[model samples]
Target: MKNTVLITGSSTGFGAAAANYFAAKGWNVIASMRDTSKDKQLNKQENIFVTHLDVEDTASIDAAITAGLARFGKIDVVINNAGYGLFGIFESFTKEAIQQQFAVNLFGAMDVAKAILPHFRAQQSGVLINVSSGAGVVGFPNASIYNASKFALEGWSEGLRYELAAIGIKVRIVEPGGATQTDFLQRVWGEGKNASIIPDYIPFLQKSEEMYANLGANSDEDAVEKIVAALYAAATADDDQLRYAPTSDIQPLLNVRRSSSEEEFNSFTNGLFLGK
Candidate 1:
């Protein structure tokens, strides 16, 4: 039987890349996005289904799954890839913005998992892949809320893996971050521009920018293509691994965090953003 993978936020970047990659591999692709019109060519591919899905809306989530199942009898994998970064000073974050960040990054993912697990439970086999970021573990400068959301996701996935494993469902988290040119980063830049910046925080924010430009995220030899490989690895692996830091600088940076003493780590992290 052919495998069907349902991916959220498939209109662009990693999600869009993944949709095409999986389809090319002959897997049935359910490319769900808030605006399906964004990629008119996505549905044109063979063995692909394009559908409207707003991660924040439970009704849309349910409908997308229903439509996907109707088109492809079974969904073998679900990639919770619908999320964005809201970066800037914490004090500048409006209440609405903070809530929206968690709503899409944490709660929306949980809701999607909840909606899909019943099917996986019945089938006794499925993969639930969450596309997390380096922010999941490392707190980037001026990205407190973004860091918080990804950290919550990391913790949630760790806790959920065992329960899902018991039902033959494999939960995997793919961590990738540190690229500045992707549509994701562009969105972050645009969103941050509108945030009401406090004068006192301006210097700190500039330092953060310097940190990112000079000593920012770790880079792998490969590019975004590594993400597709990582997703494929998670979806196809028949092992007990729960976390993957493929194609991003997360793994090496994680090494730095693990090898350093608490004080040393603190000094190192602060140095990037504080220069102290």
Candidate 2:
């Protein structure tokens, strides 16, 4: 019997890569995304099921899981990877936008995990992976909203692990560093660019712009492969480990974070964030 995985945000990036990886490994994959039209390749695979799953809508999440269960007979893993960046001066963002940010980044993952638990419980075996970011533990300039959502995800996932482990379900968090698809950051600034019309914040915003530019963070083809490998490990591993990095790119930083004291952490991170 082959194990099956259902992944969210499969239209592109890590989610899309993970779907292809799992299918190639002989596991059934339910490659779900908010817009199925964007799924250009996975439909060609015999074991991959492409479906619609708007994370903000519990109905869509529930329906997608239901469809996957029906198609694959059983789902052994759930990868909650559907989220976007919402970067800007927090003041410039409206309450609605912040809410939507959390709706997708935090609440959406929660809803997906909640919806899939019954199946996991009944089988007494499963893995749940939340695609988090380095931003979850470390803060960056002008990413307060995005950071908050991920921080909440980190905390929630950590707490939920204890609850799920006793039931035979393992939980894992995949944390990639600042590097990610350019389109992700572009989508963020595109909507909030013009909104930064408040003159009083111009200098700070300009500094943030320069800082982001200087970071030179961008994902390449190899990154997709690394991310998929991490996802596969997280889904298949039986250990009590709760966190993973796609590559050594973020390992040193994560080690520094784990080993540093609060003051040392703040000082170390400030130098990176502020170019001190």
Candidate 3:
């Protein structure tokens, strides 16, 4: 039987790309976003069913899931790709900004997983793929809040994987490195109020912004392909994998951190922070 997959934040970036990828692969795609009217491209796809879903809103999430199941009959996979990055100096981030990151990134994913678990349990087979970041495992300068949110997602996915294994519900984390072509960077907000107070961090912040604007990050096309491949593998692969590191640069870094001593890791992190 063909599987149906629901993807959050399908209006743009990785979500939209993955939606198209899966739809082309013969799966029914529930391409979701905060407003279906805003998703003109997704609405045009024959295999895609565009639906409204605001991850930050509980009512919207529940309604979207209900609508998806009603229309598709079964949601075999849920891709938690609705999230934003609040990039700024650690001291400059506000309580509200920090909360917003967790709300959409961590809480939103958890809420969707919680709401969908019942259906998966009844069916006894399902997959959840979370779009985490390289920052999920590594910390960077001027992205403290963004890193924290992804870290939370990674931890949650790890625990959920173990809990749902017996019932055949699998969970996987996709850790992509910096991808510059998406609106993801443009959607990132930084608090000047807190950032201004940290005078020493200004130079580093400027450098980071320049790098971001020039698209010094990785290619979005490559990253999206990796995500699609990982999602497809997670859905049908015979063996289990806890994590999928999509970016080549991040894979080695992850390995180093995983095997290195705390002191070695700390020293490298401190040097990077100081240099930045």
Candidate 4:
């Protein structure tokens, strides 16, 4: 029997890429997204089942898992890849906006993992691949909330791995730098209820944007492909290998964080972003 994998946010970006890659590798793919109606291409592929799964909604999460099991008999892996970016100064975010960001990025992924644990336990073998970001490792300007969400995910996955290892379940994190082809930036939500920018922060925001644009232009062009490879590595790697950094550009930053002192790391990162 082929191993089956269910991926959230599979309608686009790295999720969609992973679905296609796994299906091509002969694994049964559950290509899940929030809206199944928008799935016009992935569903047509053999061994790929496109379904609705809104990670923020527990009912939808359960329904999607049930549907996958019914179709594939057993799920071997669950990829938590559904999330969006909330960008701007921390003060610009309302309580509701902050809550919503956490709801989709952090809490939503946790809910999916929690929902699938029983099934994984029953099977005695399963992998949970949480799609994190480089921001999870190193903070970036104008993305404080996004960084926080990913950082939380990293910490959660690290602790959960130890707890789940004895039960034959594995937890891994894959961090991707920046993908050029995705609509990720276009989908990013701005500050607060009205999505308005604070006048005082505009100049700083523009500088940050310009810097990010330059960095992105210099980043690896095939980020999605690299991320898919990282996902595959995480799924199939040794149980002890918990973190996979897929992009070259981010590796140096992560290395700096790992090898430098707190003050040194902060100085380096601040220089990169704030031009200090």
Candidate topping TM-score: 4
Q: For candidate 1, what is the lDDT?
A: 0.85
Error of 4 at 14 (Å): 0.6
Q: What residue runs in model 1 are displaced by over 4 Å at the alpha carbon?
A: 179-194, 216-221
Better of 3 and 4 by lDDT: 4
Q: How far is candidate 1 from the true structure (C-alpha RMSD, Å)?
A: 2.4
* Candidate 1 least-lDDT 10 residues: 181-190
lDDT per residue as tens, model 1, 76-159: 999999998888777776788899999999999999999999899889999999989888978877688989999999999999
Model 4 pairs whose backbones collide: none
| Deviation in Å, model 3, residue 114 alpha carbon | 0.8
lDDT string, candidate 4, 183-208, tens digits:
32332335235255557877776677
Question: Residue by residue across 198-244, what tens digits does model 2's lDDT show?
Answer: 56766766666665654545434376687889899999887999988
Clashes in model 3: which pairs?
Answer: 92-194, 92-195
Candidate 1 TM-score, true structure as reference: 0.93
lDDT of each: 0.85, 0.84, 0.79, 0.86
Winner by TM-score between candidate 3 and candidate 1: 1
The 10 consecutive residues of candidate 2 with the worst lDDT sum are 179-188
Per-model TM values vs. the true structure: 0.93, 0.92, 0.88, 0.94
Candidate 3 Cα misplacement greater than 4 A, ranges = 179-197, 207-221
Model 1: how far is 268 from its true place, Å?
1.8
